[model samples]
Target: MADELKRRLVHSSGAGLVALYLLADYFELGLTWPRFQVLMVVLAVGTIGLEFLRLQVGLDWQIYDKLTRDYEQDQFAGYGYYMVSMTVAVLLFDPQIALPAMLMLAIGDPISGAVSDDSLKFVKGPKVLVTMFVVSAIIAAPFLFEYPLAVLAAALGATIADGIKVRIGDYIVDDNLTIPIYASLLAWVVIEFVPV
Candidate 1:
């Protein structure tokens, strides 16, 4: 339980990046969208490099033993997927879409993890699903208030990503990777195609 709490806390810290971006933008600190995208890409690349070392080079860090689940021992840890997914979101979507999508993973996923039990069920319970949706919607609301449909779609996407553990062979698609991508993609679809 302590380890899970620690993991969720670390997961939530990803929101700091979004906060930094917002502050930089609001205060005109010169962190433009392109600059932020570059930063995300660099961070993702670095994480991927670290993952390669951890997986292929057998560089086992002590922190991994504490934070990672048994399943992650032989697979890409969530952080790598998180960085890659976030980079993809930032590069592919506008700030209005990317920021909330990132928040869904940073804020919503942590909250869901806090409420979840130890069981690694493929599908989370109704309680956890509802909690994820609500948290995700609230996270999206400030950025996407003008587009209610987009907000709904983003929330639903985040909920689905967090609620269901999609398995691809032996590796479960971590919600850390899926949440932002799913939210951004669904929100983009609604914003681009649906006239609401």
Candidate 2:
């Protein structure tokens, strides 16, 4: 189990670091909505493709059997469904907000997962919640600084919604859902209320 967790942590962390670099570079190129959308489509497709390769090659399982053990067949299928849902949401909303929301999820969710897995001190529910909130807030800081309050509010709302979804047990709303929703809404609201 420990080995499996380590593998997952390493894989996810590497992915996140790469994503951060790409996103930072992309933003430096000029933070435009169209560019952000293109980036998201590429990322979404790439992640999906990687997951498919993992399943098809069976090499991922060999590295960590716990991947299969942790996710049931239906749960695995649900990942595809969730991805589709997120893609639709991004298409319908502003990618400026969506991008940051996605980043928050990308960064915050892993922090939560890592803490949950490794920290005996954070084993309690309150500790976990506080940790998640603090980590999420830090992730939100860049968005809040770059964008407006409305965008931040949207991101906050989305994060809360994701928390509710996870707690309710209807579906596992990963960072993908939480970050995008917040970012998108924040951008939308800011664009609506503020003048250019």
Candidate 3:
């Protein structure tokens, strides 16, 4: 499959599964803050595992390579970061908040990458990514958490930080920076707000 299509499938599938799982679990087990926490950990582990398998087996490396070029190595690093952030969010935030943030990472990040690669270019810095972040925040807010504004703000903030760290730095920023950072920030926001 094309990298863009693959990414879309991966992200949408992963996020959809997480959302479905959360909804089912909530209804079945009686929704609580702790359950949401557990869900985030579970989703992170599962998503990371799937991504690891895909990368290690070279299942999608060709497309990934073409899309990322020299920055492919950083993609693996991103996976680790994503796992850590998701775990933290689960431990710290409400599921309602965390899940939407996860969705942003899961759905928005990849979609943005695909869009940027095929349609938009970052000639003027991370403008494309920043725009993607804003759109993602707006879309994700209504579905993911009660404090949509706060979530959107957090997403925008993360976008800025990522733009600086990855797009504007002298050092190599790696192509994998987009999705991981986006997801991590969402996870962080979710964790921060989850009832403790």
- Highest TM-score scorer: 1
Clashing pairs in 1: none
- lDDT of all predictions: 0.92, 0.52, 0.55
What is the Å distance of residue 10 in model 1 from its true position?
A: 0.8
Which pairs clash in model 3? 93-191, 93-194, 94-194
RMSD of each predicted structure = 1.2, 5.6, 5.8
Which lDDT tens digits does candidate 2 get at residues 1-196?
6754664464345335336535766778564555545655676787577567766754354533543335543234333433544554556765444444554454555565565544333123544455556665565566556654654465455445434445345645444444455556655777677764
Candidate 3 runs further than 4 Å off: 29-32, 42-77, 118-127, 143-148, 167-196
Q: Show model 2 residue runs off by greater than 4 Å.
A: 1-4, 7-36, 46-69, 77-96, 115-124, 146-148, 151-155, 166-176, 190-196
CA error at residue 141 for candidate 3, angstroms: 2.5
Global CA lDDT computed for model 3: 0.55
Backbone clash tally (model 3):
3
What is the full ranking by TM-score, best candidate first? Answer: 1, 3, 2
lDDT of 1 by residue, 1-196 (tens): 7888888888888999999999999999999999999999999999999889999999999998887888889889988999899999999999999999998998899888888884878899999999999999999999999899999999999999999999999667878889999999999999899997
Error of 1 at 156 (Å): 0.1
In model 1, where do residues sit more than 4 Å from their true spots? none
